[model samples]
Target chain A: MAKKVNSLKYEFIKGLWVENPVLISLLGLCPTLAVTVSAVNGLAMGLATTFVLTSSSIIISLIRKFIPHQVRIASYIVIIATFVTVADRFLAAWFPPISKELGPYIPLIVVNCLILGRQEAFSSKNNSGRAILDALGMGSGFILVLVALGGVREILGSGAFFGFTILGDWFNPWMVMILPPGAFLTLGFFVAGVNWLNERRAAQ
Target chain B: MKLILLFISAAIVNNFVLSYFLGICPFVGVSKKVSSAVSMGMAVTFVMVIAAAVTWLIYHLILVPFGVEILEYVSFILVIASLVQLVEMFIRKVSKPLYDTLGIFLPLITTNCAIMGLALFSVLREYNFIESIFFGIGAGAGFTLALVLMAGIREELELADVPKHFQGAAITMIVAGSLALAFMGFAGLISI
Candidate 1:
């Protein structure tokens, strides 16, 4: 509470890596781990989340005053669900393959704590400008982590990066990387790695 | 036979927490004590079963017949949110002890994602009413299994010398990764 948070810059920069929704804050982990099997899927999911998140933030911010406090969460859920439907339908129509690959996870985004969390924490309290910026920053952070995770998984599982063969012919792909464990293992290590990085940065 | 297979598939083979990553939040968040975990699991199970049956009815009876499937996400979420509220009030009125145990977790269940995922999955699988109920039970059971297992291990982990950086969420995830590997053995155990 002590740090100056009034500037718009604070809201935007916080989500990129400082307080990353996935790696740091640990708000939205379901979709983060589920669809990160490939970089493409991760990017699509991230973008879709970004759209829903930003749209809901704008609407929630505008109607923040009108929503009764007792039923505010319900209202937020409805607002979020509306945008999620829009994103889900848009994805299905424009990109069928990725949509199929992501499957229920897209609609599952409505319940993603990251989006709802931002609305409750920042959007409901802040103005629309800050809400949009917060959404963009957090969404970018989520996108970055997903792409990194998916890229790593894809490379290890298939000896390829984004569908291109990266490892040599002699490389023995860890087929387990394609399975569910790969996601948990990769994320586990990534979180530990991020912690170590922060520790070292602080030691300096 | 199909119902049995579906039940086993969702429970063990395709665990909601391990394979599908549906409810990782509670899997990692509330899985600190065996007792609380058990309570959360029961609450989630109750909601999952009911949510499955109700959402199935809503989707098939109302959304599909009226060609308003577009409202699927909105309506399903609304149903789940309100359902949790109703279930919470009912429990508080019926049993004091049970309500106290599941007090905090009930509201949180609105955002659990597992229930949402279960509803979405039943729709995707196109299970009939009975089968959907079975699937709900299986998913809830599987979720409980994962949460309780994590809780038990974490209770023991309280004494272990976890690494400095991997102490909190990191270690839990690694443990979960191992559990997932163990659970993966169930994969293809029954090809049905």
Candidate 2:
């Protein structure tokens, strides 16, 4: 029992960093860069994604035995898309402002390679419990990165974090940090940070 | 004139890759080589054009009329997946050389958010049929332009001695960040 728990714990923990979907695997980047202009938006997108990722992963894991190899990809997409639709509508209904800000991105989540990749890789091969753990790990990792990236961009661009003022009148907010370039630049450095950490860990 | 402005806007001012951040997988993954980037661009543009037309019809004529508009996400994705599959098969049958060039990319295009984003954007913006097509072409052109530019720079970057940490995708991303900065200059150049 202890051994089983340990392995499962590793499955979940790996996605938090070592096999991070965003930083390490670099999947589902379009949404990462698009909606992460602000920390709030990043957190919203991350939670929405986590909901879909966890839900779909559990479903796929449950049905893994029944899915044939040839049609598995298609089956996975439909399953994934269904959950995305739910998330999209849920956001639109409950959070009108976030829904509008996120715009087509909610629907775009249907195509997010991160969700689909997890289905193909983790869920399809593992049990529902492991799939759930994996989904949460990856989801948290994704959320962590988004919130950090968004926090950095927001603080620099608007002199605020999560809509609260951080920098004073003396500091000039860099408009470029909130624009498209900032997304890439911030994410680039974040990627570097992850790489550096991994290298340090490896060397030791 | 409106169509032309839309095209230019989509292609330059509001580039899909730079502004909207769509189809980034191919932008980063396949952009290492100029040759492969061009090929991927062509494949994506071809699908985008067709997807624009077909999705417009589906959203307006089919979904709207049937009152099943909530099916938009599921339907659009299904259409794109099958469309790519069908296009791949048709290309393989119709022209060997063309298929040889684009075959590998067709499979990858299914998950490319840009194509789906284009469809959703047109629907959200309430663009008419012709405008949607122009937008598709423009987005594709913009994607191709970004990919080609990134590829060219990366080819050159192959020689530059880079730091140990910020290499590979990390460096590519920073370079893209610079390109995006340049593209931002075109922000108010035109508005349509």
Candidate 3:
């Protein structure tokens, strides 16, 4: 029982830092880069993804035994698409503004490699509780990177935070930071920064 | 004129990769070599064209007729997955040379959001069948153009003195960002 608890803890924690789905694993880049134009958008996208990831992880874990080996990939995709549709509709109904902002990306989540990767790699092999924990960890990690990226871009690009002005008047916003190029540049530097920290920690 | 604008717009102004951020996995994963990049682009183009055609029919003929639009996502994805499988087998049987060229990238197209995004975007825009086909071609062309450009830059980037941490995917992204910025110049070309 103790060993099982420790393993679950490891599985959960790994996604936070050691195996961050975005900064480290690089599993889901499209949504991570595209929808992160603002802090709020990033937060919404992350939460929606977390909801989908966690829910699908639980369901997939529960059905692991019944899924045939040959058609597992197809089954997983259909399952994921169903959950994504639910998330998409929920967003559109409850948060029309955010749903409009995210646009097709909400549906694009159905193809997010991160969710499918977790389903295939973890949920397919693990028990329900452990799989959900793994999903939570990964989803949290994804949210962390996205929010961080969005915050940085938002603050630098427009001197705003969740639509509130954070940077002082003296600071001129880098207009490029808010553009498509900015997404790539900010993520590039941020990824390099993460790598540098990981390497330094390992060396020490 | 409108069709031409749509084709050019999808291919350049609103590139699927730079602007829409679709197919980013293959953009980063298979962009190491120019030869492979071209091959991947062609395979994706082939699949995208077929997917666009098929999904339109599925949406218009069956889903819309039956009033089951809610199943669009699930059905579209399943169709794409199975279509890719069929394309793979068809390619292997009909033309071994083409199959050899495309190799594994064909199978990888199943999960590529660019194809699905193409279907979704065309549907979202309410594009007619002809426009959807042109949109697919244009998007595929744009994806190819970006991938090849990145691949060429990466070949030269191999020798450039990139910082240690920003060596692989990081640099690739930064380069893509610049390419995206360059591609942004075309936004003023057509205002559709």
Provide the TM-score of chain B versus the true chain B for each model in turn.
0.98, 0.99, 0.98
Model 2 clash pairs are none
Model 1 TM: 0.98
Worst 10 residues of 1 chain A by lDDT: A1-10
lDDT of every model, 2 decimals = 0.93, 0.93, 0.93
lDDT by residue for model 3 (B1-192), tens: 988888899999999999888999999999989999999999999999999999999999999999999999999999999999999999999999999999789989988999999999988999889999999999999999999998999999999999999988789889989998898788778877
Stretches of candidate 2 exceeding 4 Å from the true structure: A1-6
Tens-digit lDDT string for candidate 2 (B1-192): 999999999999999999999999999999999999999999999999999999999999999999999899889999999999999999999999999988788899999999999999999899999999999999999999999999999999999998989999899899999999999999998987
Q: Over the true interface residues, superposed, what is the Cα RMSD of model 2? A: 0.7
Candidate 3 lDDT at B176 equals: 87
Candidate 3 Cα outliers beyond 4 Å, as residue runs = A1-6
A53-87, model 3: which lDDT tens digit per residue?
A: 99999999999999999999999998899999999
Candidate 1 docking DockQ: 0.90
lDDT value for model 3: 0.93
